[model samples]
Target: MANAASGMAVHDDCKLKFLELKAKRTYRFIVFKIEEKQKQVIVEKLGEPTKSYEDFTASLPADECRYAVYDFDFVTEENCQKSRIFSLPGLPTLQE
Candidate 1:
Protein backbone atom coordinates (compact mmCIF):
# COMPACT_ATOMS: atom_id res chain seq x y z
CA MET A 1 0.00 0.00 0.00
CA ALA A 2 1.21 3.46 -0.79
CA ASN A 3 1.24 6.21 1.79
CA ALA A 4 2.14 9.85 1.91
CA ALA A 5 4.78 9.16 4.51
CA SER A 6 6.64 6.36 2.75
CA GLY A 7 5.89 7.24 -0.87
CA MET A 8 6.20 3.56 -1.64
CA ALA A 9 3.54 1.02 -2.46
CA VAL A 10 3.56 -2.74 -2.62
CA HIS A 11 3.17 -4.32 -6.03
CA ASP A 12 0.03 -6.32 -6.77
CA ASP A 13 1.97 -9.47 -7.60
CA CYS A 14 3.63 -9.31 -4.22
CA LYS A 15 0.33 -9.78 -2.45
CA LEU A 16 -0.82 -12.48 -4.84
CA LYS A 17 2.38 -14.48 -4.44
CA PHE A 18 2.24 -14.07 -0.67
CA LEU A 19 -1.29 -15.39 -0.62
CA GLU A 20 -0.22 -18.35 -2.70
CA LEU A 21 2.59 -19.03 -0.31
CA LYS A 22 0.45 -18.68 2.80
CA ALA A 23 -2.68 -20.45 1.66
CA LYS A 24 -1.37 -22.88 -0.92
CA ARG A 25 2.23 -23.43 0.21
CA THR A 26 3.33 -22.93 -3.36
CA TYR A 27 6.66 -21.46 -2.36
CA ARG A 28 9.19 -22.17 0.33
CA PHE A 29 10.13 -18.53 0.70
CA ILE A 30 9.88 -15.15 -0.99
CA VAL A 31 12.35 -12.27 -0.98
CA PHE A 32 11.15 -8.72 -1.43
CA LYS A 33 13.03 -5.57 -2.27
CA ILE A 34 12.14 -1.93 -2.55
CA GLU A 35 12.68 -0.42 -5.96
CA GLU A 36 13.73 3.11 -5.24
CA LYS A 37 13.25 4.24 -8.81
CA GLN A 38 9.78 2.73 -9.00
CA LYS A 39 8.96 3.63 -5.42
CA GLN A 40 7.46 0.21 -4.98
CA VAL A 41 8.00 -2.99 -3.12
CA ILE A 42 8.44 -5.95 -5.41
CA VAL A 43 9.31 -9.61 -5.29
CA GLU A 44 13.00 -10.24 -5.96
CA LYS A 45 13.00 -13.98 -5.68
CA LEU A 46 10.81 -16.99 -5.07
CA GLY A 47 12.27 -20.10 -3.49
CA GLU A 48 11.39 -23.56 -4.61
CA PRO A 49 9.51 -25.90 -2.32
CA THR A 50 12.64 -28.02 -1.85
CA LYS A 51 14.94 -25.11 -1.11
CA SER A 52 16.59 -24.97 2.30
CA TYR A 53 16.75 -22.16 4.80
CA GLU A 54 20.40 -21.71 4.01
CA ASP A 55 19.47 -21.14 0.39
CA PHE A 56 17.06 -18.46 1.43
CA THR A 57 19.71 -16.73 3.49
CA ALA A 58 22.18 -16.90 0.66
CA SER A 59 19.76 -15.18 -1.67
CA LEU A 60 19.89 -11.96 0.35
CA PRO A 61 22.19 -9.24 -0.88
CA ALA A 62 25.15 -8.37 1.28
CA ASP A 63 24.65 -4.62 1.16
CA GLU A 64 20.95 -4.11 0.61
CA CYS A 65 17.79 -4.09 2.69
CA ARG A 66 15.11 -6.67 2.07
CA TYR A 67 11.93 -8.23 3.39
CA ALA A 68 11.28 -11.95 3.33
CA VAL A 69 8.84 -14.62 4.40
CA TYR A 70 9.61 -18.23 5.10
CA ASP A 71 7.15 -21.02 5.50
CA PHE A 72 8.63 -23.34 8.08
CA ASP A 73 7.11 -26.74 8.72
CA PHE A 74 8.03 -29.26 11.34
CA VAL A 75 6.68 -32.14 13.33
CA THR A 76 6.11 -31.66 17.02
CA GLU A 77 7.37 -34.04 19.65
CA GLU A 78 3.84 -35.28 20.01
CA ASN A 79 3.86 -36.19 16.31
CA CYS A 80 1.63 -33.33 15.32
CA GLN A 81 2.09 -31.46 12.09
CA LYS A 82 2.71 -27.75 12.47
CA SER A 83 3.71 -24.84 10.34
CA ARG A 84 4.88 -21.31 11.02
CA ILE A 85 5.31 -18.32 8.78
CA PHE A 86 8.32 -16.14 9.50
CA SER A 87 8.49 -12.55 8.37
CA LEU A 88 11.85 -10.88 8.25
CA PRO A 89 12.09 -7.18 7.52
CA GLY A 90 15.25 -5.17 7.08
CA LEU A 91 17.30 -8.20 7.85
CA PRO A 92 20.82 -7.56 8.99
CA THR A 93 23.09 -7.82 5.98
CA LEU A 94 26.69 -8.93 5.77
CA GLN A 95 27.67 -5.30 5.44
CA GLU A 96 26.17 -4.65 8.83
Candidate 2:
Protein backbone atom coordinates (compact mmCIF):
# COMPACT_ATOMS: atom_id res chain seq x y z
CA MET A 1 0.00 0.00 0.00
CA ALA A 2 2.25 2.73 -1.16
CA ASN A 3 0.01 5.66 -0.52
CA ALA A 4 1.81 8.52 -2.17
CA ALA A 5 -0.91 10.90 -1.03
CA SER A 6 -1.36 9.46 2.43
CA GLY A 7 -0.61 11.50 5.49
CA MET A 8 1.36 8.58 6.89
CA ALA A 9 4.68 9.52 8.46
CA VAL A 10 7.76 8.47 6.59
CA HIS A 11 11.34 7.80 7.73
CA ASP A 12 14.41 9.80 6.85
CA ASP A 13 16.76 6.97 6.05
CA CYS A 14 17.18 6.67 2.32
CA LYS A 15 17.39 2.93 2.80
CA LEU A 16 14.38 2.48 5.08
CA LYS A 17 12.24 5.17 3.48
CA PHE A 18 9.09 4.45 5.45
CA LEU A 19 8.02 4.09 9.07
CA GLU A 20 7.18 0.40 8.98
CA LEU A 21 6.20 -1.17 12.29
CA LYS A 22 4.47 -4.14 13.86
CA ALA A 23 1.06 -3.33 15.31
CA LYS A 24 1.58 -5.46 18.40
CA ARG A 25 -0.69 -3.21 20.46
CA THR A 26 -3.28 -3.18 17.70
CA TYR A 27 -2.63 0.48 17.17
CA ARG A 28 -3.86 2.36 14.13
CA PHE A 29 -1.35 4.99 13.23
CA ILE A 30 -1.70 8.20 11.30
CA VAL A 31 1.79 9.39 11.97
CA PHE A 32 5.10 7.60 12.58
CA LYS A 33 8.55 9.13 12.14
CA ILE A 34 12.06 7.98 13.04
CA GLU A 35 15.07 9.53 14.72
CA GLU A 36 18.02 7.48 13.62
CA LYS A 37 20.46 9.06 16.07
CA GLN A 38 18.41 8.86 19.26
CA LYS A 39 16.72 5.69 18.01
CA GLN A 40 13.55 7.38 19.09
CA VAL A 41 10.18 6.85 17.45
CA ILE A 42 7.50 9.49 17.13
CA VAL A 43 3.90 8.51 16.69
CA GLU A 44 1.36 11.21 16.05
CA LYS A 45 -2.15 11.54 14.79
CA LEU A 46 -2.97 12.31 11.20
CA GLY A 47 -1.61 15.76 10.61
CA GLU A 48 1.24 17.76 9.24
CA PRO A 49 4.65 16.76 10.60
CA THR A 50 6.05 19.77 12.39
CA LYS A 51 7.35 18.79 15.82
CA SER A 52 9.02 15.43 15.76
CA TYR A 53 10.59 15.60 19.21
CA GLU A 54 11.46 12.77 21.56
CA ASP A 55 8.52 13.69 23.82
CA PHE A 56 6.01 14.09 21.02
CA THR A 57 2.95 11.86 21.44
CA ALA A 58 0.10 11.17 19.05
CA SER A 59 -3.00 9.12 19.66
CA LEU A 60 -5.87 8.26 17.36
CA PRO A 61 -9.26 9.59 18.24
CA ALA A 62 -11.76 7.00 19.44
CA ASP A 63 -14.16 8.09 16.74
CA GLU A 64 -11.56 8.06 14.01
CA CYS A 65 -10.63 4.87 12.30
CA ARG A 66 -12.33 2.72 14.90
CA TYR A 67 -12.21 0.24 12.07
CA ALA A 68 -9.52 0.44 9.44
CA VAL A 69 -7.17 -1.55 7.29
CA TYR A 70 -3.39 -1.40 7.34
CA ASP A 71 -1.00 -2.43 4.60
CA PHE A 72 2.79 -2.59 4.88
CA ASP A 73 5.73 -2.88 2.52
CA PHE A 74 8.97 -4.48 3.72
CA VAL A 75 12.25 -2.61 3.64
CA THR A 76 15.84 -3.12 4.83
CA GLU A 77 19.33 -1.70 4.74
CA GLU A 78 21.75 -3.47 7.07
CA ASN A 79 19.12 -5.10 9.19
CA CYS A 80 16.75 -7.86 8.07
CA GLN A 81 13.33 -6.33 8.46
CA LYS A 82 9.75 -7.53 8.47
CA SER A 83 6.61 -5.38 8.31
CA ARG A 84 3.09 -6.09 9.51
CA ILE A 85 -0.39 -4.63 9.42
CA PHE A 86 -3.16 -5.85 11.69
CA SER A 87 -6.32 -4.77 13.46
CA LEU A 88 -7.35 -4.91 17.12
CA PRO A 89 -9.02 -8.02 18.33
CA GLY A 90 -12.39 -8.15 20.14
CA LEU A 91 -13.85 -6.10 17.32
CA PRO A 92 -13.82 -8.41 14.40
CA THR A 93 -16.11 -5.92 12.75
CA LEU A 94 -13.04 -3.87 12.07
CA GLN A 95 -11.41 -6.27 9.71
CA GLU A 96 -9.58 -4.57 6.88
Candidate 3:
Protein backbone atom coordinates (compact mmCIF):
# COMPACT_ATOMS: atom_id res chain seq x y z
CA MET A 1 0.00 0.00 0.00
CA ALA A 2 1.02 3.66 -0.27
CA ASN A 3 1.83 5.81 2.70
CA ALA A 4 -0.65 8.59 3.32
CA ALA A 5 2.05 11.22 3.69
CA SER A 6 4.92 10.27 1.39
CA GLY A 7 3.02 7.89 -0.90
CA MET A 8 5.74 5.27 -0.51
CA ALA A 9 5.08 1.60 0.07
CA VAL A 10 3.92 0.88 3.61
CA HIS A 11 2.16 -1.98 5.34
CA ASP A 12 -1.56 -1.72 5.96
CA ASP A 13 -1.10 -1.96 9.74
CA CYS A 14 1.28 1.00 9.61
CA LYS A 15 -1.34 3.58 8.77
CA LEU A 16 -2.52 4.12 12.34
CA LYS A 17 1.04 3.94 13.53
CA PHE A 18 2.00 6.63 11.06
CA LEU A 19 -0.83 8.84 12.23
CA GLU A 20 0.21 8.35 15.83
CA LEU A 21 3.75 9.30 14.89
CA LYS A 22 2.56 12.46 13.17
CA ALA A 23 0.29 13.30 16.10
CA LYS A 24 3.24 13.16 18.46
CA ARG A 25 5.35 15.32 16.16
CA THR A 26 2.87 18.21 16.07
CA TYR A 27 1.06 19.63 13.08
CA ARG A 28 -0.93 22.75 12.29
CA PHE A 29 -4.68 22.04 12.05
CA ILE A 30 -7.70 24.19 11.63
CA VAL A 31 -10.87 23.19 13.50
CA PHE A 32 -14.13 24.67 12.36
CA LYS A 33 -17.58 24.70 13.95
CA ILE A 34 -20.67 25.85 12.08
CA GLU A 35 -23.64 27.55 13.66
CA GLU A 36 -26.23 27.31 10.89
CA LYS A 37 -28.92 29.21 12.73
CA GLN A 38 -26.59 32.14 13.08
CA LYS A 39 -24.99 31.53 9.68
CA GLN A 40 -21.51 31.69 11.14
CA VAL A 41 -18.52 29.43 11.15
CA ILE A 42 -15.86 29.59 13.83
CA VAL A 43 -12.32 28.65 12.91
CA GLU A 44 -9.41 28.04 15.24
CA LYS A 45 -5.90 26.69 15.01
CA LEU A 46 -4.96 23.68 17.10
CA GLY A 47 -1.94 21.41 17.64
CA GLU A 48 1.38 21.71 19.33
CA PRO A 49 3.23 24.88 20.10
CA THR A 50 -0.27 26.26 20.69
CA LYS A 51 -3.45 24.16 21.16
CA SER A 52 -4.46 20.51 21.28
CA TYR A 53 -6.96 18.57 19.14
CA GLU A 54 -8.85 17.39 22.22
CA ASP A 55 -9.59 20.98 23.15
CA PHE A 56 -10.68 21.83 19.65
CA THR A 57 -12.93 18.80 19.33
CA ALA A 58 -14.43 19.45 22.72
CA SER A 59 -15.64 22.88 21.63
CA LEU A 60 -18.10 21.31 19.23
CA PRO A 61 -21.54 20.15 20.28
CA ALA A 62 -21.61 16.60 21.55
CA ASP A 63 -24.94 15.98 19.85
CA GLU A 64 -24.74 14.58 16.34
CA CYS A 65 -24.41 17.45 13.87
CA ARG A 66 -22.77 18.28 10.57
CA TYR A 67 -19.00 18.70 10.86
CA ALA A 68 -15.79 18.25 8.93
CA VAL A 69 -12.23 17.19 9.73
CA TYR A 70 -9.54 18.07 7.21
CA ASP A 71 -5.99 16.80 7.26
CA PHE A 72 -3.80 19.78 6.47
CA ASP A 73 -0.64 17.96 5.41
CA PHE A 74 -2.33 16.64 2.26
CA VAL A 75 -1.96 20.06 0.68
CA THR A 76 1.14 22.07 -0.19
CA GLU A 77 2.17 24.98 1.98
CA GLU A 78 1.52 27.36 -0.92
CA ASN A 79 -2.04 26.07 -1.22
CA CYS A 80 -2.49 26.26 2.53
CA GLN A 81 -1.37 29.89 2.47
CA LYS A 82 -3.83 30.72 -0.26
CA SER A 83 -6.60 29.03 1.75
CA ARG A 84 -5.89 31.34 4.65
CA ILE A 85 -6.27 34.36 2.42
CA PHE A 86 -9.46 33.40 0.57
CA SER A 87 -11.32 31.20 3.09
CA LEU A 88 -12.28 28.74 0.34
CA PRO A 89 -14.21 25.52 1.10
CA GLY A 90 -11.22 23.30 0.41
CA LEU A 91 -7.53 24.02 -0.09
CA PRO A 92 -6.97 26.96 -2.41
CA THR A 93 -5.38 26.87 -5.84
CA LEU A 94 -2.03 28.59 -6.51
CA GLN A 95 -3.59 30.88 -9.10
CA GLU A 96 -6.19 32.19 -6.71
Per-residue lDDT of 54 in model 3: 60
Itemize residue pairs with steric clashes in candidate 3: none
lDDT of 1 at 65: 89
Model 1 Cα lDDT, one tens digit per residue, 3-64: 33456777777778888888899999999998899898889999998999999999999999
> How close is every model to the real structure, measured as TM-score?
0.86, 0.22, 0.27
* Residue 60's lDDT in candidate 1: 95
Cα lDDT of model 2 by residue, 1-96, tens digit = 221233432233311222332324232333443334544333333322333322123343444433222334357795766555543322131221
Model 2 TM:
0.22
**TM-score: model 1 vs. ground truth:** 0.86
The C-alpha local distance difference test score for the whole of candidate 1 amounts to 0.82
Rank order (by lDDT, best first): 1, 3, 2
lDDT against the true structure, per candidate, is 0.82, 0.33, 0.37
Number of backbone-clashing residue pairs for each candidate, in the order shown: 0, 0, 0
Q: Please give the lDDT score for candidate 2.
A: 0.33
**CA shift of 73, model 2, Å:** 8.4
Report the CA-based lDDT of candidate 3 relative to the real structure.
0.37
- Mark the 10 consecutive residues where model 3 has the least summed lDDT: 86-95
